[model samples]
Target: MKVDIMKKRRTVLNGKPFSIVDDLTKMDLTERKKWAPQVKQLYDSGTRLRFSGGKWRDSAGKSYIFVFNLTLDKKGGVQKTNFNALDACLSYLDKFSLDDVWRTRNPLSSGFTWTSNIDNIRCRLDFFLISKKLVNKVNDCYFQPPLQSDHHIVILHCDISIEPRGPGYWKFNNSLLLDPAYIDLVNSLISNYSSDPHNSNQNPASFWEGLKFTIRNNTIRFSKLKANDSHIYEKNLIKKIAQLESDSISDENLLRELKDARSNLHLLYKNKLEGIMIRSKARWVEEGEQNSKYFLSLEKRNK
Candidate 1:
């Protein structure tokens, strides 16, 4: 699912001219009753609402609609005043078949949000109301900790099909010969093939075919072994460095090991990038220019 932030002026919500009265908590019962029709109108027009418990005023002289219990404690409870206001707001939404996404999925549980050390009043300070049509499209809902907010992030996984990717094309890395270990492995494979007695009586075509098959098998086996070792080596080096730093200690030997591992990992990445460029048939990406912005942009376009 794609995620993004939608920022808009409070004067116009869901493309409608609505007053921006943001402080729903300070609103008297009469004011809430006054705005009920406007809220219903917006909800009917495919406007999803997120209650933030934070207030603001907009150009249209309307209060921002942030009506939720912000100061909840621990055990799923709320102040009488806050509970009344929440009930009124939810009553309006429930009339139009708009429901909390999480509560609808699990009716026996209360939603979660920002908490405080106040009177142990557990409540959901953050919430979203979705119409029946959009609710049907939703597949799952969960929360993630926000990077820079006190509130947890809410995520919606909808039943939207992603664009299908094309069939992949594979290419062997001829640069493998540059590595001493790879050269030695290839030579050893050839030596073993020549010494095998099973192919001593084979014709010229059969001998070449058998040799090619043996080389391909050996290449695949070595490639798998190297791939596994490369990943494990990189992971172990990173873990070692992290452990040393966490203990407030420094070791020159560990540092050297980490540096060498990083160099090798960089080489692997370079090989993969070159392979990608070759597969794209991008001749414009000259040597030493593969990391340039133009090369990256063109490579993405080609893919």
Candidate 2:
């Protein structure tokens, strides 16, 4: 038998204590027999459930918030779901001390998060679950019209303040390694450094360190130049997309152009996220092997 495991995308913003978990289960909870085991396994994952009341919590005791398309309505009262699946989910939340932010904050609220164009059917299938202790911080919850999908965007507003953070250390951008121009520049820098006679009197260690410092400074400048170009290009794409959307509202012929622009923007973000993940994995592997102080503290704190 083949079994598929549910995966979640957990993101932690800088200076933010709580994590934002995006559900990628792609399982409809109403299909109890098919999804129950997967749901159970997901809830049983130690990484997801272990952070409650741990060092992950903020000053307000908020540890993490889950935003998911659960496909089961707890408030709509019209959507059908297997009793066993509902009970399992509710029981898991109760056991983990989790709270349904929307249900608790707005009991009488009625909204449809999904719609079927074929049958004109609507259902509330999205949810925001958070620590019960952070319920009071929920300022408001509402749903917006669908942009390009049948599902509406669920917006959860919280009253928590974001702590301001200072500019952190600079790390080499691994993506630059793929750029031919950057590679040529680096080669030129190394060639010049090797041929310079002014540093020939220096010791081996000092010479190596000086070469690294020079490369670092040049890399920083190169990265800044590329970043400026990227920002300008992204801004232009955003403007073009907005214009296409406005034109498409009146002329349906522009819908294809709008979609293409949106896809390009999405691809841009996807590439950037991939770069971030690569860097994060590389850092984790480097630090893990060294048993560095930062990772050691992180492991102990999580434990």
Q: What are the lDDT scores of the predictions, listed in order?
A: 0.53, 0.55
lDDT per residue for candidate 2 within 1-303, as digits (tens), equals 112422534333333344343232232333444644664565555323212110122223333222223342322224444454345455556876777776676565444565543343555656666767667767886665433565655677767657677865777787899999999999999899988997767899999999999999999999999989988877777667534432214345565666676687667765665554454443445332433344445534543
The C-alpha stretches of model 2 lying farther than 4 A from their native spots are: 1-167, 249-256, 282-303
RMSD of each: 12.9, 12.7
TM-score of each: 0.39, 0.41
lDDT for model 2: 0.55
The superposed Cα distance between candidate 2 and the true structure at residue 131, in angstroms, equals: 22
Residue pairs of candidate 2 with colliding backbone atoms: none
Q: What is the TM-score (0 to 1) of candidate 2? A: 0.41
The most accurate candidate by lDDT is 2
Give the lowest summed-lDDT range of ten residues in model 1.
Answer: 1-10
What is residue 4's positional error in candidate 2, in angstroms?
31
